[model samples]
Target: MVALNMTVDSQTGERAVRFNIDALVIAGWAGRNREAMEHHIAELEALGIARPKATPTFYRVSPSRLNSDPVVQATGENSSGEAELVLIAADGDLFVALGSDHTDRKVEAYGVTVSKQMCDKPVADRVWPFSEVADHWDSLILRSYVIEDGERVLYQEGSVDGLLDPRDLIKRYTGTDTLADGTAMFCGTLPAIGGVRSFTTFEAEVEDPKLSRTISFRYDIAILEDVG
Candidate 1:
């Protein structure tokens, strides 16, 4: 289990907990915009998947695949990163964190779920209580930057409202209103600025304009030589 140094509350007292994660669920095609969803569907069609009937598709991943390290290794050179808003459920409480739903692009053509299993998912160590940001949730923004030939350029940016809310996504996935404790879900991402492309380094964050705080994380990619 991955233990998080979480902040429960600050105004009342310095309440913290070591949140344990037992499941990692990836929520795909979670866009609230039908146009954006069609755009993503067209993009994924180029990768070999047909149009999906559901607004949000749930993919279960091994909890052991989650990591907090700032670096991850993948086979060959086709892995790409998609910045997502992650939901962490711990002991009946919900929290939010930033995450990269890093996946193997080459393997994606074969199967999205199988491709999801090909890489380790990385998340920020810091998190915000869902209660604290629930009111101003739509104001939160998600952005990602990637290093291309030594320069950091914006890759993806949009408001969190672009995707389905945590409550709806949780209910859709779990068949309930609340996510069970020890469950972590990676909410889907927004479209890239230009287009999707692989990079050596990726940085992403979730910015809370109302609170004036951000939860961000950066990680380097190591492309191991393909033996085949």
Candidate 2:
């Protein structure tokens, strides 16, 4: 199990709670926009994957990579990053945070499952209790930035409304009313503003306008030489 020390703050004092992650589910092609979804599928196809079926796909990875560390190590330089909404089920309570589903694009072409296992996923330290944000969930915004060649650029920006509802995704994955405790799912992401690109550092945030608060995190990437 992956142990994560996450912080929660409010009228009460801030506390660092150790949570054990039992599963990591990465949801793919979950955009609500058909054109955008097609765009992503075409992106994957360009990398040599066959045409995708007309349904959302879920890839399960080892919980050990569901990390909060501010740095990630990659085996090569071909991987790109994207921001996504993350759902965490801990001790029978659900929480939401911002995260990056960093993937090895080259390896993904061969097998999405194996590619997902090649890199560690990074997530924000602070999270909101799902119940607190459930009423205003649609108003939440998800965004991401990438540091390319010493320049920081806005890689992605969109509303959570652009994706399917969390409950619906959970239902599709678990075939139940709620996710099992210790499960963390990285909900789908929006289309990149320009195109998918590799980065030296990745940053992302989840902004709740109604509550006037945001949860953000950044991580640097270390590309290891592929000697194979």
Candidate maximizing TM-score: 2
Query: How far in Å is the alpha carbon of 152 misplaced in model 2?
Result: 1.1
TM-scores, all candidates, are 0.93, 0.94
Q: Write the per-residue lDDT of candidate 1 for residues 51-161, one digit (tens) a residue.
A: 766768899998777887888999999988999988999878788888899999888877888989999898887778889998988899999999998899999988988
In candidate 1, stretches whose alpha carbon ends up further than 4 angstroms from where it belongs are 5-16
**What local lDDT score does residue 122 receive in model 2, on the 0 to 100 scale?**
90
Q: What would the per-residue lDDT of candidate 2 be over residues 1-228, giving only the tens digit for each residue?
A: 898888874425567777788889999888777887788778778777656564678989998887878788898898877899889998888888778899998888888889888888898888888888888787899889988778888988878887878888999999997999888999999878777767889989888888788889999998899999
Residue pairs that clash (backbone atoms under 3 angstroms), model 2: none
User: In candidate 2, which residue ranges exceed 4 Å CA deviation?
Assistant: 10-13
Q: After TM-score superposition, what is the CA distance of residue 227 in candidate 2 from its true location, in Å?
A: 0.9
* Pairs clashing within candidate 1: none
